[model samples]
Target: MMLPGFPEAAPLAGLAGGLLIGLAAALMLLGAGRVTGVSGIVGRAFGINDSGMSWSSAWTFVIGLPLGAFLVATLKGGFEPEFVPLPLLAVAGVLVGFGARLGSGCTSGHGVCGVSRLSQRSLVATATFMIAGIATVAVMGAL
Candidate 1:
């Protein structure tokens, strides 16, 4: 559904996506006994971190991420994704990777699973992420 001021906002779609993410996180935690942290999974997959998660499992999770998004986008008649230049995108990726490593976890781990479990570190990290995101939007808008 469209939001009042944000005419293109899809609340229903957002809700559905959130639910799916939560469900997936819950399943990962319950079934695999692990947090669905993408960064950690990637690190494990690449042999950068040995968190006891299997390489195959980590690869499966990483591959399923984009595969799931692509399936949904295709079902919805596809979408055009805008991107910054390659150099800028690469820089942003590096920055984000560094931040995630420094923070010990990314948004999915901290904001979703950790927060739900009432972890203090996750709460603070999620708050910090929100503030940073807001500041970034404000700065971009001002430019």
Candidate 2:
């Protein structure tokens, strides 16, 4: 689906975004021997014991995300998303994040890196997430 307010450059923009993401993931794995798993990174942020360098890099990446977006907007220009509501967004974020942790990976981990590695568990988890997302949208549409 076309995102509201994104220019005709959206597809190219998306390609660039995907390329950057893949490059970052590949670089992380090659350089630090770490999987770019958002849930795992967040878990490490919450005091999970792992390699100090990996945890620190994960933390840096997490912190850099918003900053990078801001820089991109400054360079490329874009619309900022309007929130449904702060409280609702916060609650949903917490629930989704917890679910990601419980599922042992986030969308990026399962959808990108894991699938690329041909991991069966990642395939199943990614499928489950996609199905759940579709169902949620359908139910919301009905409501």
Per-residue accuracy of model 1 over 15-125 as CA lDDT, tens digit each: 889999999999999998998888899989989897568999999988998999999889988989887899999999899899999999999999998899999999999
Please identify model 2 stretches exceeding 4 Å from their true place.
Answer: 1-6, 48-55, 78-84, 141-143
Give lDDT: candidate 2, residue 41: 75
Compose the digit string of candidate 2's lDDT tens values, residues 31-58.
8787788777766776664534555666
Q: Name the top lDDT candidate.
A: 1
Among all windows of ten consecutive residues in candidate 1, which has the lowest summed lDDT?
Answer: 1-10
Question: What TM value does model 1 have?
Answer: 0.90
- The per-prediction tally of clashing pairs is 0, 0
lDDT of each: 0.90, 0.82
What ranges in model 1 sit over 4 Å off?
A: 1-9
RMSD to truth, every model: 2.2, 2.6
